[model samples]
Target: MLSTGGSALIAKKLGEGKEREAREDFSFLTLVSFLFGIAILLIGNIFIEPIVRALGSTDALLPYCVDYLSVSLLLAPAAMLQMMFQTFFVTAGKPLIGLMLTISGGVANMILDYLFMGPFNMGISGAALATGIGELIPAVIGLFYFLFTRHSLYLTKPVVRFQVLKESCFNGSSEMVTNLSTAVVTYLFNITMLKFLGEPGVAAITIVLYGQFLFNALYMGFSMGVAPVISYNHGSQNLPLLKRIFKICIGFISISSILITIMALVSSPVIVEIFTPIGSATYDIAKTGFFLFSINYIFAGINIYSSSMFTAFSDGKVSALISFVRTFVLIVLNILLLPYLIGVNGVWLAVPAAEFMTLFLSVYLFYKKRDVYHYL
Candidate 1:
């Protein structure tokens, strides 16, 4: 929500030549995000045990969950800041700096993971600590940059504008919905997997989900990276540029979708093997399901991009509707009905079915809003 709302508002302000207003929005967003993060930190820690148990963690898994989340929740503020700054960096025309910092954080995470798990033998807590610190690195650096340095965007005296807050929240609600729905969908998948095939079924789904995350990151990253430019063009009334960008985005998404689907299909066996030995029950299940699951990628890119594009245009209602339906409504319906209707294969088919249906909605909205946004 912070990233989407902040980026759109900031870019629009910049496009309007309202530099002071842009900085004020950025500073306001930064303050609000920090406060939200602190709230999460407190609430998460206070309810950590119940939250973990509610997720269906077993007795064996409870300790590990507690250990990890206890430390991880402490860095909620940093995580929130890091997420907000990523998009803001692009808005400020410092995308490369943001990318480099993120890469550095990832490198730090891997190194720390090895050291903590292998050398220090800190177990799950160590892993959580490492991850939290990884989040903190970019967050701290980004915060300092905004606070101390002169740039297109920087910290300023934040004017408490209720209208701005309302607009930002309303405009970014789709992203918030997307995130919340992911958690819900993941929980449902776990419960359904457990019912059908026990632990092996759960393991199999986990493997496929890991692959989903990696593959879907490509679409998500692209959408985020281009959102500021879309907002800027829209704000500046650059209709021609908006039209060109829309065409380029659609073309890129179309081509990437096909290529990613092919890559995923060809690499399924290797991906499954990485998690489990060949011929194992989990391996067999995941390998077979991966093929079916990967079909979602063919339609997911367009849906993802369409929702993001609407958000960039500051049409929160349309964007939220798209995200809510695509991620939660259709997904929940399919996850519940499909598995019962067609057995385990139904489980694999649920996401693809949802994404395919969502493609129609996305296209309809794109066509409907073209004139409104002047991106036809």
Candidate 2:
């Protein structure tokens, strides 16, 4: 949300050819992200134990949670900075560089995960530290790159613009809401599954959802990559080019949704096998749920893109409304009502139902705003 919000403004500024203002806003975002990181670090440390407990960690899990949280908090600022630069880099017309930087960070994370957890035997703390350092590398490198480079977009004199900051926050609220709703929906799914299928049920659901996460990541990356272009064109009032981009993006998402759904169905066994052995109870449950849950991808891509497109257009309220309805309202309703209606299968179908229902709203919003955005 932060990254996209900042990128929307910066991309628009670039389109307007206000290079100095763009750089200043870039600096503002970077500064804000850093301060937020520091705030998180301080608050997290101060209430670490209570926070862990509030998250429902039992006594047995408390020690491990504490260990992980303690190490992770140290890198809070870095994490924030990393997020800001990821999209800002794209706004700067260096999407490939952003991709490379992220890939490098992921590689560093994987390497450190192995070394720290295996050789050093640092346990959860090792994992936390590895992730923290991974984020830190990008944060530091991005800071240096923007600060020292002579690109179209670079960090300049920090001029805190209150109105710009407020707009960014408002524009990004939908993404934040989506994330928060995911957490809430996950909790709801767990409870629903537990009531219907017991402990093994929850485990199966988790494994299947992990597959969804992997596929959703691809959709998210594509949406984010295209967002800046959309914003830039919209800001420039290049109706013809903006319309072309919109058509291409929507077309690609539609095709990919069909392909992803088919792939998930075909690869269900393989995906399930990665987490459990064949013939195990968990394996059987997950395989079944995975197939049923795979139906969601067919509808999810368009819904995800709808919210992102609105954000790029700087229509935060409408974007947030779409996200809230899709991620929270519909999902919650389905989870609560479906299990009772169709038993165990209903639980697995909850997300698919939610996504399918939300697609109508997404399509409606897109058509309704076509005239306004001149992208019909």
**Per-residue lDDT over 1-376 for candidate 2, one digit per residue giving the tens place of the 0 to 100 score:** 6777778988998999999998888788788889999999999999999988775455766798899999999999999998888888888888888888888898999899999999999899999999999898888888899989997999889898988898998998889899889888877776677677776777798898889898898889998899999999999999999989999988999999999999999999999998899998889999999999999999999999999999999999999999999999998999888888888888789899999999999999998998889888
Off by over 4 Å in 1: none
Alpha-carbon lDDT, every model: 0.92, 0.89
State the displacement of the C-alpha of residue 341, model 2, in Å, after optimal TM-score superposition. 2.8
- The RMSD (Cα, Å) of candidate 1 is 1.2
Minimal lDDT window, size 10, model 2: 53-62
Q: Candidate 1's residue-wise lDDT over 294-372, tens digit each?
A: 9999999999999999999889999999999999999999999998999989999999999999999999998898778
TM-score of each: 0.97, 0.94
Model 1 weakest 10-residue run by lDDT: 1-10
